[model samples]
Target: MTAEPALRLVDAAHPAASAEGVAPAREQERPETAGAQTLRRGLAVLRLLTRVGPGGLRMGEIGHRLGLNKTTAIRLTRTLVDEGFVLHDRAAGRYRLGPEAFAVGLAAEPSYELQRQAAGMLRALAAESGDTVFFTVLHGHESICLSRDEGDFPIRNQLIKPGDRWPLGVGAGSCAILAALPDDVVADVLARNAALRAEKFPRCTDASVLSLVRDTRERGYCLQPGMVFEDSWAIGVVVYDANEAPVASISIAALRSRLGPARSAMLGNRLMQASKELTAQLKA
Candidate 1:
């Protein structure tokens, strides 16, 4: 066949052919599959339970806080209870973490070595300072309160308990972790946590957090002067890993009246010393 006739025949046979063909459409338009969403919601319920302490939460409160519908919350909690990750207190009309949850947490002990190592330090700090001491670890753009020790102080700052999660720049220990990071990392963390900070921690703007980072770097510790709660003040010092990277922090929280400038500085230095000891232990 002549070149023109051959070309015409090829075009007729493959009229839709192109150098850049249309990309295939996605098979699943949703961000997550139904099964994945159910699993995520289930985990969310479990995390929420961790934060509420022994009191647990009512079904309506859980549904309200998580934005889960009444039926969905019921189903998820029922499944978790059936699986032994949760327990329904029929008499109290509430749900709390069950034995399986503790088992799972215990199984993950290796991941919480810092928490284990810092427990003694936390107790000593709390005893010496007559204040509440907390151990927090960095997790993504947030920080998790791994443990806490209470002092004999008459009035304690009970704002942050174990299992509480905060954006990196919100709490004293979290701010210490964020401040120990490089400037670029600090910026990225602020950007990622901006929305949550605005909604939950309105006072912790990027600018304000940067200011705190500068101050922490200068002082070798963080003094959270009633940022989270006007009457609650705290001091924090970062603990470094063997490679000298910041991994976790120790913090002391008390009433603002108790944390005067001199006392704040003293506590900050004390925390720094405790952090150094922990860092040495981790290095060993």
Candidate 2:
């Protein structure tokens, strides 16, 4: 205990325990937990709102769509509003997409090169078929128009601009996409859409909607006569990715009078070929 002859010091020593007066050893940071994962859920909510279009969803609708409770939906919306990702309209008691979201969307557009590359193919298909062609991708439970080309026909279906949302089981484009989804996902989308349709278009029932989905899958495409617009017919083919997953849909819209058996067959062939070509381009 008495300093034992002053223990001899050795020049050979370990590295300093501190670097620049800061401890080198510190606790490792942990990955995100459940609460942190909620951030992603919030972002998903914002995306769903945008997909729903300018007339954003109400609290209850958002909750129903996301499988969250009303309280959770309100809380999430409040957070989004605070962050300027969504704007609540007090007068209309509805929500609209905020400016900040638009800024982000504008920035992200070019990153999705598929839309740009598919535009040329869409135009060529339109010119060849003389029928209005639409390129749409799935967003949440809706199909969003990403690009379109007008036909040379004297009378054609009006163009659906980018960002326009349509219910997943309503028209040929939506049905084609939905049919390609997993069975459970298709059922869930149809069930949710059935409730929405009852509120919006009461004439369309769940059975009819399911029938359309089945027919689309059976035929490898969707053909809807006057489902979306009066006197308009649409034929849709699914555009697949390298994994054979349906990533988008290519639809031809024409006047009902011009969609006879022969015309329908020709349009179907053209749409199928264009969709295959576009899918190949996406793969490349």
Computed on alpha carbons, the lDDT of every model, listed in order, comes to: 0.80, 0.72
Question: What residue pairs are clashing in model 1?
Answer: none
What stretches of model 1 exceed 4 Å from their correct place?
Answer: 1-34, 54-61, 64-67, 89-94
Residue 230 C-alpha lDDT in model 2: 51
lDDT of 2 by residue, 1-284 (tens): 11111111111132232111101111122588888768866876886776557777778888887788888888888988998888999987887789888899899887667678788888888898877788888777877777768767765455355556677776688788988899899888867666555654443467777787888777777888765455667899888876788878999888788888888877877787877887788778
- Report RMSD (Å) for each prediction in the order shown: 19.9, 23.9
lDDT of 1 by residue, 68-158 (tens): 9999999999999999999999999999999999999889989988788888878988899988888988888778778878787766555
User: Ten residues in a row with the worst lDDT in model 1?
Assistant: 1-10
